[model samples]
Structure formats: structure tokens, C-alpha cells
Target chain A: MSSINSSGEPAAVRVVGGWASPFVNRVVVALKLKGVVHEMLQETVGKKSELLLRSNPVHKKIPVLLHHGKPIAESLIIVEYIDEVWASNGAPAILPRDPHGRAVERFWAQYIDDKIPPGIRVLRGSVAQDKDKAAGEMSTALQHLEEAFVECSQGKQYFGGDNIGYLDIALGSFLGWIKAVEKIAGVELLNEAKVPNLAAWADRFCAHPAVVDVVPDADRLVEFTVQHAALLRAVNVPK
Target chain B: MSSINSSGEPAAVRVVGGWASPFVNRVVVALKLKGVVHEMLQETVGKKSELLLRSNPVHKKIPVLLHHGKPIAESLIIVEYIDEVWASNGAPAILPRDPHGRAVERFWAQYIDDKIPPGIRVLRGSVAQDKDKAAGEMSTALQHLEEAFVECSQGKQYFGGDNIGYLDIALGSFLGWIKAVEKIAGVELLNEAKVPNLAAWADRFCAHPAVVDVVPDADRLVEFTVQHAALLRAVNVPK
Candidate 1:
């Protein structure tokens, strides 16, 4: 096994992430949970730097973590890399030790990551002529998500239970977005009556210290969204 | 470290995958790389049985690996899980230890995975007007992909290097579909002259033993495409 650095610090971890992107937040949560201190560089979707572009030439998107000038892209991939490097005994690892249990958590995280984006897509396209069609699609996706949460949360506090693990970090990033999406779309995905467990899970997830600490300013996020909403409306992009 | 069980196997691992899915193939490649003996169940997509449905009720998708009856869903997630569990000391892992390298590879994988489908979307839409728009969208996406390949390869043998790794495995799954897409759409994303490195990479990928041994029957896939091509054409789909 590799020895921990004498300085008790990871080798200069730096994160290039946007304030409003839940995708970026997943990585932040992982870094925090693993107790890895990183230099957080604020970025925006529209304005990418040469460093960001060069570091991640293919995607050229934020949530690019530069560890000693080496970059890792994609939020979940970064999380996995974090787990592998910071394998401190008894420290909060992002993955479950049991392979099966780990897989279960991973399955739910992927489900939520893939499906939940459509609701935001719907909200982005709200003013379109086919808004109803997108809404229906978003609604079905949310229904599936609600079902997913019920199965995932059965007999567990977090997705891996007790301490917040991979799934919690994965889903926790979206809690802020869920409220924003609901307000923007005028549709409640996680209604108290419709999905009590998920609603509760969201509450517990937001309350996690690791999550609460790293999330961007909620008011700022709302302002960003309001600005973005206008931009979408002007372009008639339908998201 | 855990002791290897009798017969030198770490433990019994099984993959629930569909023959038609690239997602499932990602896990298959990882298992082969690690030299883990496991069972492979060929599942029918969109027509899953109770076992699969129950195993992954949230996503209800295949590429669910049951290690000692514990299910892991999502292809990339399964790949990571496989790497974590069956990883050999000093042996190749799908992701790089270096953060930046890992990030770049992951970002492209996610970008290609998310963006490439949109190109296919234009081919899949039924409207007459939609077909032309889809072609244009697809062309632009391919342009980005070709340019990305030129930038990312930087003369590296594989996305990870020398041997196939995560990014190669991720993109390799799409090659089988690309030819069919090109034939049907009458548009070439990877011409020999246009994308020599990518074209060469695809060739090297297909001929790899791990990729060749377990890949679904190409002839059968082409036959399926042949039969379905007319139907897709009738709808003015990509075919």
C-alpha cells in the first residue's frame, strides 16, 4: 500500500466547478467526505478558461479536478478517483466495502443522475408549444425516480445507510435543484403525499454537514436560474 | 488484503447483460481485463424478467452484476466496481491514478455518451423536416468528435495508453453502431482520410482479443439492422 504523504495533505488537489451545477457538487461532497482539502476554482458554463479548456480538451466543461496538474473529468469518475487515492483506513470512503452493496448504491446513483435531468430540461422548455409533451416525459421520469427512491431507501438511512456514502452524495447535489425545478416548472416532483420517503430522504440529505458546507449560495443559485430562464426564453431553445 | 478463495478466484462474480447493449459490454471488458471468471446472462432489453426487474427495480436495466447475489447496475459504475474489487497490484485499472488524466478521459466519455445520442436522435425522428435537421445536428456532433479525437489522442496508443482502458472501452461500444449509422444516413463520421487516428483506433479495438471474444455476433446485428432499415427509412429515421 502507498504511504500517506508526511504532510497529511493530498498532492495539491484543485477543483474547477460552477456554483450552480449539481454535477460539480457531487465531487465537492466526495472530496469533503474523504477529508481532502482542495483549491476550489469557481467557473461558469459559458465562460471557460484556457486552463479549463486545455485541462479538459474533450469535454471542456467544469468540475475538472486538477491534482498536481493532472485532471480528472466527470463528477462520478472524480468521486471514484477520490475514493481510490484517499483510502484512509476507517475514513469515510465513497464506496461500500461489500461489492454487492456498493453496486446497489451505484445503481441508484446512476438512475438518479440520468433520469433527474429531464425535469430540468422540462423546466427549461416550459414555454414551448411542445411543453406539454416535455412535461409528460419529465413527469414519467420523476415517477420512476420516486419509485427508485422507495426501493433504495427501504430499511436504510442513507443509500448505504447511517453515514452518508456515494448515493447520498450523488443525490444530495440535486436537493437544491429539485426546489428550483419545482418553482420553475410549477410542478412538484417530490410532493409530500406522492413521495414521503424521498422527501424525507432529501431532508436528511440536505442536513448532512458535508453537503451543507459545500453547496453554493442558494440565493445566488436562484438568481443565476432566473437569469438563465430569461436567456432560454429569449433564444426559444426549448432547452 | 482478502485471501483469494480456492481455485485462485477472488470470488464468484456474474454479469447480467444484454447482447445488444454497449453499456453491458463495458463491464464485460473490465472483467476480462481482470481475468475474473463469471457467468454472463444475455438479457432481452425492454423485456426483462422478474430477476432483473427485482435486482434493479430503480433502473430496470441490464448490465447488473450479481456478485454473490448482490446486484450492481449501470455499465460505467459496474466497471468501477469491478476495478475496485478485482484490482491486481501494479496491474492496469480502468481509471488513471493521476487526477487530470482521469478527469479528461471521464469528461470525454460523458460528453460523447450524452452528445452522441443527440446525433442519433435526428436520425430517429419521424418528421420529414426533422430528418434534415437531424442530419445537420449529427454532422456537427461528429465534427466535434473527430476534432476531439485528434486533440485527445496526442499520439497515445489508446485513450488510457498501450492497452485498452476506460475511455477506449467506453467509445469502443459505439463503433458497431457507427457503421450502420453511416450506411443508413449516408454520412460518414469516421472516414479514413477524415479521422485516421480514430479509424485506426477502432480497428485496433475490434481486433483486441478481449473485445473480439465476447462481442455480440456482428453478422446477426447487421441482419437485424437490414430488416429494420426499411422501417426506419419509412419513418425518415437515421436509417
Candidate 2:
């Protein structure tokens, strides 16, 4: 840990993240859950900051955590790093203490990362042909996630049992996006009839005080989607 | 850990892997490095086994480590699980003991996973248009990896300082494929002048006892690539 700055704040803790990115939101939720005091630096998409590029030269992506002048990239990796560094800081454990349990959590978190992007593309696609094809792919991805929730949750409020854990934070950050996508695509992704447990889980996750404070405003995110509709269409041209 | 079978062997330690898969090879190298007595269950690429599907229902992917009848999927995650479970079995540490060092190792291992597949696609592309585009993408990816070696290795014999570690196992498993791809594409990917450190790193990695024992024979891998050339070309068609 680095010493406090002249302003009497933790000098080492800083995060470069985008306003509407689920990946960035994951990191923000983790930091708040861990009770770490940090400054958030906003980086816009299509125009990344020099700091972000320098910090993450390989990917030049956001959600890079700068701790004591060192940068760590990738959202899940950053969350895991936060968990390990702040393990003794009196916060709830993000990952289970046991090795096997931790492995299970990691498996699901990776699963979410693997599956969600296709769904996002489907929602953002302006062409009917692309949207239909992506819808089928996204459906299969969501079905797998639903099965995972049933198996891993075991009827608990969160994947970490009583408290929200790694997979919860990983997937929970997407609730607002899921809503925005549903509106844009005119389709339901997590309907109560189709994925009841996951629907409840999303509601509970979004309602958490720590998460609520950090997540982007839903109406603004929806508005952001509409504002960027043409850009999304151009990026998601039928393939 | 589970009890031994009637033969007094660790009956539960088994890996479902494919001979030609770099992902599968990563798991094999880790098992051998940790000195874990495990059985290797071979799987064909297109014709996946029922056992593999049953073990890993979510992904249905190979390199699933079956420990005590429990299945763990995804190569990197499985390697981490093996490291943690066998930590006390007198094997070399796969990840650095310090949290920050471990994070750095994880980041690069992930970088390799994210970047190498696209390079492989470029090498396998049959169409000139696709190949030309893929070549530029592959070059950029390789350059980033070259820089990574310079930054992380620091003139050491391995990324793990004096010995092999997580990133070493993760990237080293692709050695045979790299050789085969270079031959197939008629291009140099890791030449001494281009990426000297990584070139030396690859040579050291391939010569290591653990890696040598598990990596598929170089000649056989080249033959495999030749046999599957059409399939590879079809899959790599500009997507």
C-alpha cells in the first residue's frame, strides 16, 4: 500500500473506466464493496485517454486499476487483485477462501465474460438479419447461464451464498445493459418465465446499496444507447 | 483429495484432453510439472467424447481436469486449480507467491489467450485477402508479445524468474503449433532478430523436461496440420 497524498487521501487507488461499460462497472462495484477509497477517471469510447493507453498498452482498454503507480487490466483480474490485496481490510470476501470454491467462482465469471459479448452485439445490431442470428446465439448463451445459476446458486440469494460474490458482481453489472438491450431490440432476455431465478438475482443485485451507488443511471444509459444508435449500427453491420 | 483405488493409485486424477490442442497441452504440462499422477484421456477435435460432454456440460470443451470425480473446465482455470490443490505435494510453485507478482503473471497468461488465436487464424487463412489482413494483425500481436517478454523476463531464463511458472506453461504449450504454423504459412513468427527474448524463451521452454514429456511430437504436429489444412482454411475464412 502507498502513503496518503498531501490532500489526505489514498494516493495509489485510481481506476480508469468508461461511464456505460459493464466491465468498468464490475470494477467499480468491487472497489465499493471492498470499502476502498479511490478516484474514478472517466475514459470515453472511440477517444481513449493517454493515461489509459499508457497504463494498458497491450489492450488500450478501460477498467485499468492504478495502484501505487502500477496498472492492472481486465475487469475480473482487477477484481481478483482487489480481493487479494484487500483481504485483511475487514471487507466481505469477493471470492471464497477455499481453493475449490474459488475455482468454481472463477469458472462462472469466465463463463460470463465468454458469453455476454455476443448478446450485446445482438442487442446493438440494427439489421434484422444480424439481429435474428445474434438472438439465437444469445439465447443459447443465456440458457447455459440459466442452468449455471440453478446449479451454482442452490436456491441462495447470491452465488456467494448470503452475500454477493465474484460471479454476482461479474454478471450483476450487466443488468442495466440488459434492460437497455431489451428496449432496443424489442425482445426480452431474462424474462421471469424463462429465467426466474436469474431475474430475481438481477433485481437483488441491482438493489444493493453498494452497486446502486456505482452503476450508471438506467434512464441515462438507455438514452446513451439511443444517442449512439447510428454508431452501434455502423459497428454492428451485418456479418 | 480422494482415496486411492484398489491398485493404491490416485484413481481420481484424470484429464480429458486432445493430443493436438495447445489448451489441453497446458493442463498436461502443469500436471507433469506438479508431479501429479494422472491419466490422460484422449479426445478427437470434431468428434468429442461423451465423457468430455458429461464432465463439462456448460462448455463441453476438453482439457477438463477430473479430480475426485469433479470436473473443472477452461485451461487456465484448471491449471490454477491444480496449482492450489497440489501446493503441498512438493511441486514447484506455478504462480508467484506474492499477490502482485501473481497478478502480473495472470495478466500475461490472459494476454496470450486473447491474442494468439487471431494469429493462428491468420496463419491458417487460405484466401490472399484474409491472409494479408491476418498477417498485419498477427504481426501487431507478436510485437506486443515481444515487448511483454522484454518487460517481464528481464533477462531471466523464464518468466517465472529462474524456473517455469504460469505464463510459461500457458504460452509454452503452443510451441509445437507455432512451429507447425510457421512452416504452413511460410513465415517467421519468432525469429531471433524480431523477438529474441521470446525466441530464447521458447527454446528453453521446449527443452524443459516437463514440457518435453507432454508436448506432442513436432513431426507429428506438422503432419497433423497438413492433414487438417483444408479444415483449418475453411474455418479461418474471413469471419
Docking class of 1: acceptable
| Model 1, global lDDT | 0.68
Model 2 chain A: worst 10 consecutive residues (lDDT sum): A230-239
Clashing residue pairs in all predictions, respectively, total 8, 0
| Ten-residue stretch with the least lDDT total in model 1 chain B | B230-239
Candidate 2 residue-wise lDDT at A84:
88
Candidate 2 accuracy as TM-score: 0.91
Top lDDT hit: 2
Tens digit of per-residue lDDT, candidate 2, span B1-239: 13356788657788888777888889888888898877788776456689888988876777788888888888999999989989998888999887778888898888877767667756755444475566567667667777767766777888887888898887787777667667777777777897778888888898899888677765777787677668646543111
Model 1 misplaced regions, further than 4 Å: A1-11, A44-57, A89-91, A124-156, A184-186, A216-224, A232-239, B1-18, B37-40, B43-51, B89-92, B97-100, B117-157, B216-220, B229-239
Candidate 2 per-residue lDDT, tens place, A1-239, comes to 23456778556789888768888888889988898878888776456689998998877777799998789988888999999899999889999877778888898888877767657756765444577666667667777777777776788889777888898998888778777777778877888898888888888888898898677655777788777778656543111
Q: CAPRI band of model 2?
A: medium
Interface residue Cα RMSD of candidate 2 after superposition: 1.0
> Candidate 2: misplaced stretches above 4 Å?
A1-5, A8-10, A126-129, A230-239, B1-10, B125-129, B230-239
B202 Cα displacement, candidate 1 (Å): 2.2
Model 2 chain B lDDT-worst window of ten: B230-239
Kindly give the stretch of ten consecutive residues in candidate 1 chain A with the minimal lDDT sum: A230-239
